[model samples]
Target: MTLNLENEQNHELPSDCEETARQVIRQVLASENCPYEAEVNLTFVDNDEIHRLNREFRQIDRATDVLSFPMTDWESPANYSCLEDDETAAGSFNPETGELLLGDIVISVERANEQAKEYGHSLKREISFLIAHSMLHLLGYDHMVPEEAAVMEQKQEAILQALGITRDPEVRS
Candidate 1:
């Protein structure tokens, strides 16, 4: 797996945040039992930039913590598969790595920081959660309905727990 990360914001994010995000992505993919070698592009942006993206892509004017643009379409988790030979899939692959391009994840660093404070967790934890959530989106998970949201949430929590990324006890109360 390769994570192509770009920092488009002015914020001085911690140097290790990129590496941490990569680890989180790896964990998510592994937990989902994804078979294909994959590549994901991650961009870190400020509130204003993310707001612009949200408006352009989703027609929402507010900045969001994360947005995922998946390259492939799968109906459900049970039927997840990556077809390397398909023309649609082939067009996205990296020739050198032969990794299937999973698509992009855009994260607003400002929103993430605010969410971490609001949710009483560390910035790393919040970012990790965002990455995990986005990875699931790339793998055909959606939270549009109650049942779908429940499943997605369960997968996110399980991936985080497997990574030993539990919320702090002090933060829970």
Candidate 2:
């Protein structure tokens, strides 16, 4: 559950914001009923970097939002292989780093700022939500179906609430 965050940006954001993001992601992982520890590489980049990545990796021409690169594609439990070593990736545990490989999540800080303004929330909250959402995707959770979407969304809200990240909540005076 260790997050090796590589902040590849010069944009200004609150100090400890990355740690807050790490905490939220860890919270979700701890509550998740799964096996194997996965290492999450969160890269904070600008819009251009994300856009280029979006085009190269996803074959899209635009960078709309967050992108998730899952380690494997075990969509169904019948074909599930969590108990075994993943064929799609290097071993979850790396001796050099002593961390599980959970794939990567690239986020656009520039876009996150715009989203915060559009959504009427602080930038911290918006970025935190995106991190949480991407973490779920890393854990094989998705919102492709209505039922599955509800469960995933519920988990997201619960994590955010658990972190006490709310809209305009009174801070200690």
Candidate 3:
């Protein structure tokens, strides 16, 4: 997997944030049984930037912790079989690198800090949770409905637990 990460915010994230994101992405893809190499773009921005993005894209006035923009529409969440059947599958892969272009994720570092404090967890855990949540979105998962939200939440918690980045104060990453 290849991750293109950029930080536009002044907020200081954990020094190992990139590695944490990569780990979460890998875990999500592996759990989903994705057969192809993948690529993802992740960006860190301040509350103002994310608020603008939310208003522009989602039409929500509030600044969100994270937002995902997926590149493809899937018949089923995390199912790669549709890609094999679609003639446009070639468009989803990078021409030179041959990695599937997953999608983009934008995170608000300011919001993450606030959420971390509110949840009584480390910043690393909060960021990791956001990455995991957004990765699932990139793979076509959503939490708009209660059932879907439960599944997404379960998967996210499982991924974090597997990485040893849990909500418990005893566990730290």
TM-score of each: 0.90, 0.84, 0.96
Residue pairs clashing, model 1: none
Question: Candidates' lDDT values, in order?
Answer: 0.83, 0.75, 0.91
Point to the candidate with the largest lDDT: 3
Per-residue CA lDDT of model 2 for 12-53, tens digit only, reads 675778788778877877777445565788888888888899
Better of 1 and 2 by lDDT: 1
- Using TM-score as the measure, the top candidate is 3
Prediction 1 global C-alpha lDDT: 0.83
- How many pairs of residues collide in each model? 0, 1, 0
Could you report the Cα RMSD, in angstroms, for every candidate shown? 2.6, 3.1, 1.3
Question: Which tens-of-lDDT digit does each residue in 60-100 have in candidate 1?
Answer: 98989999998876656524444644765666678898897
Better of 1 and 2 by TM-score: 1
As a TM-score, model 3 comes out at 0.96
TM-score: the better of candidates 1 and 3:
3
